[model samples]
Target: MTTSPNAPMTSPTRRDITAETGLPYVPPGTIPAPASAYDGLPRDTAVAGDRGWDRDSELSQMSKAVIATVFGLALLIAAFAVIGRLGGWAADYGTILVYLAFFLWMSIAGRVFWWGADTLIAEIRKKSNTGDCR
Candidate 1:
């Protein structure tokens, strides 16, 4: 059979395709079957009843930021100690340079830590709301 070129094309139904191809047919936009009843649950349910800190909470995020900042400070101190031992720069400049460096480090680190915490909290909120934490 022939059809006119101007005719509108029609999509075949699942039954039509299955009959023609002798294979199981899945309609377009059909969602796949879930593996288990739990598969449909929200991702946050894993920690729903827990008494511990919520991983996505602002307090938890801020604690993480504090820990990270402390770790950075430790590294900065270690680096300064190593430099002092190798070049004696600290001895020449005394505590003044150390204070200045510490002030600068705290200022920059504070900003970075807050920014990181804010970003992480926002992402967690977005994922939670969208049910796409995974």
Candidate 2:
């Protein structure tokens, strides 16, 4: 909060920062926001900031893959049971089980990919900011 002697300090508080920038102050190390803080904004929660679509797309893809794998396994199991009872399909059981296992493995792989991507992006951001020294 220090300013050069030649520079005039007009605003002194978080309220003043909000008034000047139209951005609210979120306390450090907290995620859940109280209702009173977001009363008049368009959304129920405050925006943390934007990370661009590459990050967003990776996250979305990971979520969709996980959900698809879970539901796909359930559907395959049900289909196998029905086929085994109605029409003899014992020959296909081993293959379907393998596919289900592969999908589950893919879900875990997707998680690891997302984690690595996030870590790389964060490191890049940190390096870029660290370069802007006085």
Using all chains and alpha carbons, the TM-scores for the candidates as numbered come to 0.33, 0.29
Q: Weakest 10 consecutive residues, lDDT, candidate 1? A: 81-90
lDDT of 2: 0.58
Name the best candidate (by TM-score): 1
Residue ranges of candidate 1 with Cα displaced over 4 Å: 1-91
lDDT of 2 by residue, 79-128 (tens): 55555343233345666775666567556655555555565566567767
Indicate the residue-level lDDT of 107 in model 2: 65
